[model samples]
Structures are given as C-alpha cells and as structure tokens.
Target: MRTDLCGRLGSGDAGRAVTVCGWVDRRREHSEHLAFIDLRDHSGVLQCVVDGARDLRSEYVVRIIGTVTLRPEGTANPALATGEIELQDCEVELLSRAEPPPFPLDERTDVDETLRLRHRYVDLRKSRMQRNLRARAALNRAIRRAMDAQGFVEVETPMLIASTPEGARDFVVPSRKEPGSFYALPQSPQIFKQLTMVGGVDRYYQIARCLRDEDLRADRQFEFSQLDVEASFATRDDVLGFVTRAVAEATVAVAGHDPGTFDRMTWHDAMERYGSDKPDTRFGMELAELTPVFADTEARVFQAPCVKGICLMGGAETLPRSRVDELVATCQRWGAKGLAWMRVVAAGTGGSALDAGVAKFLSAAEGAAVIDALDASPGDMVFLVADERPLVRHVLGLLRLELGRPPVNDGRFNYLWVVDFPLFEALNAEGEPIPSHHPFTMPHEDDLPVLMSGQPLDGEALLGLRSQAYDLVLNGWELGSGSVRIHRRDIQQRIFEVLGIAPDDAQERFGFLLDAFRYGAPPHAGFAVGLDRLGALLVGEENIREVIAFPKTQSGADPLTDAPSPIADTHLQELGLRVLPPA
Candidate 1:
C-alpha cells in the first residue's frame, strides 16, 4: 500500500523515502536504541531498522516508511535480493498482530502434514508453498495459452451428470429434484469433451476438475485437475502432437527449459525392457532376462515359465542381510513365490560368482551363467523373481524402483509416449475380453481383419490385439491416456460384442452416445494431462498434494474444512436419503 514492495527496495532505491507493507518474518535486537525487522511479502523479505522498543513479533502484519540506505560494511546478506540495502529511521504502523505460530514456519522445519493442513492459512505463508502455488497458476495459464494457440476452444463441462461408471468409483450426488436418483461428478471432461466433438467443435479443451472415490497415494487424490482435450477428425499422431505442444510449452514456462522431443516406446518393449508400461528411463538397473540361462538348471526356484533379475549396483555392500530378507518378504507380498537374491563375490578363477540365496542350488557353471546374465559386478547384489511373465515383470519392476529409481525431481525430464497397449487387458470368467481403455476405442487398423473375422478369437490373440490408445508418461508416472474413437456404429457394436455387452445392455448404459453416433459422429482422438502430477513434477515435489493449495490428507480428510463430516438428518431427508448401519 506504499511506495514499494518490501523486496523491491534495493541499492538503487538508496536515499529514496519509501513505504512497504508486509508480515514480520523475524525480529532481532541490534542495540538498545535500534532493531532489525525482516519484513516479508510474497516477493521476499527486506531488513528494516526500527526502534528497539517497538513491539514486533514474527508474522505481525505491519507497514513501514523509511529511507533506503546501504547496510553497514560486511553485514550484507548476499542470500537476499535486497541484501545490500536496509530501510533506516523507520516509522512503524502495526496493521495486525499475530499470535506465535503453532509450528515452525522456516523451510527447514519438518512439521507433521496434518498439523500444517489444519493451520493451512498459516502454512501457505511459507516460501515453498508460495512458490508451488504460483508455479501451478503459471502452468495452468501456459497450458491454456498453448491450447488456444492450437485453435482449440475452451469449454466448460457439467459438474453433475448421470453416473455411468467407467474405471474408478464415482463420487455421487443425490438429486434433490428426483427422490431416488443421483448425479455423479465428472472424473474428467471425457464424455462431454467428446460430445463437443460430436456437436461439431473441431477442437475442445478445458482445465477440468475431476473427482474419484479412490484410495489416496502420493500421486493420487479424490479430487484433482487435468487439462482435458478432444478434437474431431484427428488421428493418433495429431492428438499426440497437440498434447506434446501444450505439455512442452507448460514445462518450459514453469521449469524454464525445453524437454526436447518426447521419446516413444511400444508398450510391449517398455514392459519387456523396464517391466513397466510407464518406465522411468532416467537411470539404469534394467530388468535382465534370465529364463533361458536357467532352462536346464536344477534350482526349483529358477524353474519357472518366466525368470527375471535386476542388478543393484553396489548393493552387496550397501544392503545388509536384514535388508535383503525384507526385500524377499516384500517380493512375497507382491505375489512372487520367493525372491532369490545373490550377492556377487570373487570366484576361484577371478570372475564374479553368485553367493547366497539360490546360489547353492545351482551348479558352478549355472552360478557363473547367472552372474553373467545379470552383468553383476563383484560388489553388486542381484535379486531374481521366477513366475509367470506378468508376475515376474510386476515384482521386478517394483524391485527396480526400490533399488535404483532417482528422486522425483533429481533427474532430467524424460517425457515418454507409450503406444500399442493391448486392446483388452484380460478375459473375464465368461471368456469375454475386457476392454482396455473403453469399448469405443478404435482397434488398430492392422488388427481390424482379425476382429471382423467371424471366427471366435482366442484369449492370446485377443490379449495380443493392440488398440490405438497411447499414454503420456513422465518419469514413470502415467500423466494421461487417449485413443482414437470408433466413429462407426458397426465397429462400436463389434467391440461391445467382443466384450460380451449385448445390444440391449449397451443401449441402456450408453444410449445417449449411441444415439448421437447415428447422427454422424466424426472420428476423434483426445488426451488429458494430470495437471496435479505435472505441477508436482515441475515444482520438484514428490507428492501432488504439495502443489495443490488445499488437499485432502492421505486418509482423504480435509482438516481445514473438516469435510466428509456427518450431515444433519433434516438435510439428508430433504434429498430422501438415510444413513444405514455398517454391516
């Protein structure tokens, strides 16, 4: 409310009488007559010299008018932007007095998340949170600009709509007008954005709020935001290009560097090489193939349809026996029959040899073969899993991350586009192939013949069939996915038939969409970027909640608002709802 911001006063403003308003970050006594007050605003902190007797405490809101002057020799705080100058002979006005903070406000403090969340109004004053919040705003703005520049129109989608279950459990809202009906919150602008394409909006976009009644994790929350997009008459490459442009622009805008061209990999290759569809390619420790190495072995543990191992460089010395046992327990918990660990040691012939775990079960030649297969160094520790291919990949993928994955922000950005996902993940008990993305996804053109054939497809052939779906992954986190839509009704019906969804049942669930398709739906493709995850990555935060302004705790409770609390009986009755006892 004055001549300058606290942080905006520098040496160039020397001899200038300026006024500044901010909260008192710190107060220190310099002498009986003078004191130093670190006045802070969103920009930064500025040192103000005031009367020592003036009452000033941390977080006290105040305004000061003083002449900017150079600090005494050798007292400059090079760490601060206004380090070279100080505001002297200040007139202080106490705007508001603040009580002592419940927890330390410094960046070094490790306050419990619940405590911080409960006092979020205060927690937000910290520099880290301030930076994160501002970065998110900037990222959103950049995304909007990118979309707009790409000739996409921003459209708002409905917050309440009929509950058509997709993947995650929907957070339903009771319809007050209709006694027993409910409206579900949109998980994404997925359907509405697609509808926009059908309605002839060639390109559509929105920074949509999404909700899912799902378990919370570091990267997931019940409520989140995404950059939703859809475009009519767009091919797979067209959608990828649009999404890449937006994301790369946002990354550069927030992180100040281009991520260059995003790398591409087939889902099969990704799973085979790194054991994850979203592979973290920043570091090594790749899963090694060892099934053939033990094809003729006597070790029962290694006698499985699939066997894979990962070498933890220098893990032999870093991981103790207890830690190795814990890894074994962890593998077992992940459904592996047993985890086989071998610490590479010097052999009689100077080459490395496998020692410990399943080492004794193998012959000398087999032991050497195991060591060679994994490319294990003498000081390394190798963990092996033997089971079906899927189990082996799942266990070893997690194990690889446990052993060698870098911190979320430690490595350079490695944007990836994973394509060629299976058209169906698996077959259900009724021998119907489960749709991977959705029933509407267009099967890859090359696989159309197989689908069109009258002969029933086998589980292997169905599972091997690739859809046109693709995912945008960053550092092992799946940002979002999209696929080309089947514009033709016949293709859609055929997909439903494959999934064992009868015409009547399909009509009931997706009647509106099917009816719209009869009016000539255009071929479209789209993608959504999880803005929360992207923001977290841009700000170097491991948890998406850190970047979110007000986020639910891991238990999905909002400490600030005390949300999810019980409602009054009268309120529930208004919506014709009643609470029921737990079974």
Candidate 2:
C-alpha cells in the first residue's frame, strides 16, 4: 500500500515522491500551521513535516504522499536510521486513530508485564519486540538454509500421538470418537524422527513444535519449538558436525560471526572442574580439590569423603562477616552440612594467614595446605565444602556461580560439547538406576560388556557404563542433547530390563519403537536446539519470552485472550469428559 517503508527511505531517495503509511509514533507542534510527526512502521520511523494541522496525535494511522528532502542543518535526527532525511509537501490521510496507549510504545520503559501481555498487540508495536521477532525469523531461515545445503530432507512429525510417559507431563487431547482414549501432544518429536531413520529417510529435519506440561520458568514455556533432527547411518561426530554448521550459520545470521569449533569436555571432567554438566566457562574460579590437602588434618570436620574449595578472588575483605554467614546459610539450604571458610590474608610463615573466626580450628600445616591448594593470594578467600563427593561438588558449584557471574556483554561465547555421560544414574527413591539421557541411548562401546553381561546391574555397575550421548551447552545453559541410538534389538531390550521396565511394560510403552528395530532400523543420532532459548541468547534477551511473539505468563495463561478459560459443557460432553472439582 506504500511506495517504501517509513524507515527504508533515506537521502538517496531525495526528490522522489513516496507514499508512506504507518502509525504516528510522535508528534510535535511548532504552531497551529506547522508540526513534525514521526511516522513509524515495521521498517522504522520517518519524520514527516506536516504543514496543515497540529491535531495529529500519537498512534494515528496515516498515509502521506510526499517528496523526500534532507533535514535542515540543525534538525537532523542522527540517532535514527532515516535521521538525515525528512518528508515534505505531505498530503496526510488519517486511516485510523488510537487512544493513548496504556504504556509508552516508542520509548522503552518499565511496564507491568501483566498489563503488557494483555495488550501484547500494542506492546509488539515497540521497536524492541519488532527486532526480537525479526531476528528469530532470520535465525530460522539461516538454520533451514544450512541444513538444506547439508542434504537433510525436511520432514513433518506427528503432533498427536499416544502418551509415552517418560519425561515431562504431556498435554493430552480427548479422543471424542474413542471415548476414554486420548492423544497426547508430543513432548518432542523424538520417536517419530527416529522412526523416520528406520523408514529409510536417511536425513531428516524440522523446526518442530513441542508441548510440555511442566512448571514454567523465565527460559521456558508450555509450548516451545525445537530444531528437531535425525539421520541414519550417522556417528555421534557426524551428527555433531552437521548441528555445529547449522547453529554457527544461525548464530551468524543473528550475531554476524561464527562461534568457531566448540570446546569439548567429558561429563566427568565437567562435574569435577565446574560442578555442572553445562558449565559456563566464560569466567573461571575453577573448582579446586582440597581433599588431598586435608587428608591428614586434625580437624574432624575436614575428615569427610571430599573437600572441595573455590578461591573467591577479591572477596576476602569485601564480604563482611554477616554476608559470609548468609552465604553459609545459603550453602546449608542447598543441602550442605555447613560452609567452612578461610580468608586468605597476608602471606605468612608457610602459606597464607587465616582471618575468619573458624580458621582457628585448622592446624598450621592444614591452614598452609588449604592456601596452597587454592592458590590463595592476599585478596582471595577460600570457601570449602566437605561431604560426600557429589554433595560437596554440588554446593561449591552453586556458590561459585553465585559469587563470580560472567561479565555482561563481553561479546564472548562459550560453546561446549559434554560427552561420556553415564548411561544410568542412581535415583534416591527409585527401584532401579534410570536412563541418564533416554532408554534408547546406546551404551558406550567400551561399556557394552558392563551392560550386557554384568552379573548384577547394580547402581555401581550401571554408573560404570557410559552412554554415547552428548549435550551442547552454551553459556551454562544446556542448549540440547543428542545420542547414538541403540538399533540392536537385544541391546534395547537389555537396557529396558536394566531400568526395571518389565518385558510387558516395555512393549506397552515403546512397542512400536522396539518393533521398528526388528525391521532393520539403521544406526542413527540427532540433536535438537531450543529455538526460544537459543534465540533469546543470540538477541541478548535474558528472558525467553522476549523472543516469543505471544508468550504465556509464568502461570501459563494467555492474558491477551484469557486462554485456558473454561470450555463449554456441551463440548465437554461431546468429548465424553468431565471436569473434576478442585481439590
């Protein structure tokens, strides 16, 4: 409906007649006969010199036929894309007018999220939202282009399928024709894409929709999208290479640079060094093992299975005793027995002088060893956790991140591939060790005998068996995970048996998948990247909701339309369902 977008016009278009249509972003009046109106559209805003009226208000949708002219010497808006030019000789036609918005649209200011969400249409009119959504579109296009170049065949997967109660709760749909039967929305396209590999679709990809009935967080939504992928006759490295190329292309489309080859680490090393499988390697006060240093200590508290410490650089004199106590409380809340600490004061007789009240508990030898172990300097303090190895690492890991957050907007990316995850992990209240990633993940080649022929599949035995699964982590967030599939029938069944899934139950749950294996399922592997989460990071948004157009609130309600409202009784009856009374 217009010759050019509002912001797309510039000095190059000078002397050319153009018809621009957009909302009136801002209007300033010099007199009753002259005014300046910043007309805005998706492209951006163009300043229009209106000679007729001062009645034009913000958000008045208008069409203007005018000649582009350079702005006067001192009036050019250098801050804008169309800053150097202005529209003159304008004939304005108001197509629509709007009431004052509930909140400012042109300038970014804090607005209540609930109010903004309820009027998301108005909120999206802002420049920030427009940029976020546009970046997402670019990201998807880049991913598709890269994958297409790599010989992947895009395929759509089923949304309505039988419930496979493996991970998060599913959003189920009542099967009206079948009475009590229901079709659950896919938590992922995991099974369907794997089946595609078996069906002879050598390479598959989809920008797939997924639903999970789980608690919402800042980076999560009830409905999300994943770059679902699968491939036949592919090794773990083969899939990783393809995924890396696609992700680099997408990130480049958004950030204008490749992230280079990601650094790799084993799951064992990740936990020990950073205390997280998806460690944020951007900054380092890397975890230090003090267990060896305190082995022969006289202090009873330091006689635990593990002693891990992190040197809090420049935190010794900065954190007051009260704050230190609060940090100790925080550690206890995270399941630590108690947080032990030592302030690394001036260099002393052997290592470093201790200052904290509890430092008296340690002998001279023990204190010196602690300082040396952590490489403590004058401006450092050592915080230690002593307990079972797992809990100690867990506490120190949490504390490390709390203390040393990465610098904001450092223009650095830390992409890590964490491999060699245990095939099974012990559960505190479980009957048997469960699959660490998924039941179908192939056991590592070296651990195949431990899985297939171990006398007893005890917790210890299960822990020794590693999986061929790998996770892609970026800036401490687990972007996604992929694994080589167990295409062998015997191996798949053995894994099910080890997880305590009875033969009958296994058939009832994954019968189709196991049956597919019987029909020559080729070896396959794939990974899925969270589009919302990844896009948010790429665009420098902390909350994933910023990248989503119509996101639900944390409570999972659509304020705009008041979705998840009550359904009509007639419709429920037609579907043979009844709403139960609230507990």
Scored by CA lDDT, what does every candidate get?
0.91, 0.89
Give the number of the best model, judged by lDDT.
1
lDDT (Cα, tens digit) per residue for candidate 2, span 1-583: 7899998998999999999999999888888788999999999999999974647888989999999999888988889999999999999998997899888885558888899899999999988899999999999999999999999999998889999888899999999999899999999999999999999999999999999999999889999999988989999999999999999999899988789998999999999998888898998888898899888888888899999989888888798889999999999999999999888888645446777756999988778777777888876878989999989988888998899867524677778999989997765367688788899999999999877884676677777789999999888878898999999988987888788889999989899988887888899998898989888888878788899999999999999999889999999999999999999
The runs of at least 3 residues in candidate 1 whose Cα sits more than 4 Å from the true structure, single-residue gaps closed, are none
- The Cα error of candidate 1 at residue 560, in Å, is 1.0
- Please state the error at residue 394 of candidate 1 in Å: 0.4
Clashes of 1: 0
Report the alpha-carbon TM-score of model 1 versus the true structure: 0.97
**1-583, model 1: which lDDT tens digit per residue?**
7878877778998999999998999999877788999999988899999999898999999999999999999999999999999999999999999999999889998999999999999999999999999999999999999999999999999999889866889999999899899999988877788789889999999999999999999999999999999999899999999999999999999999799999999999889879999999998888888899889878888889998889998999999999999999998998999999888998777889888777888888877777887888799998889999999999999999988889988848899999988899988898888888988889998998898786788889899899999999999999999999888887888888889889999999989888888887999998888999999998899999899999999899999999889999999999999999989
The runs of at least 3 residues in candidate 2 whose Cα sits more than 4 Å from the true structure, single-residue gaps closed, are: 52-54, 349-351, 428-431
**All candidates: TM-score:** 0.97, 0.97
* Cα distance off (Å), candidate 1, residue 184: 0.4
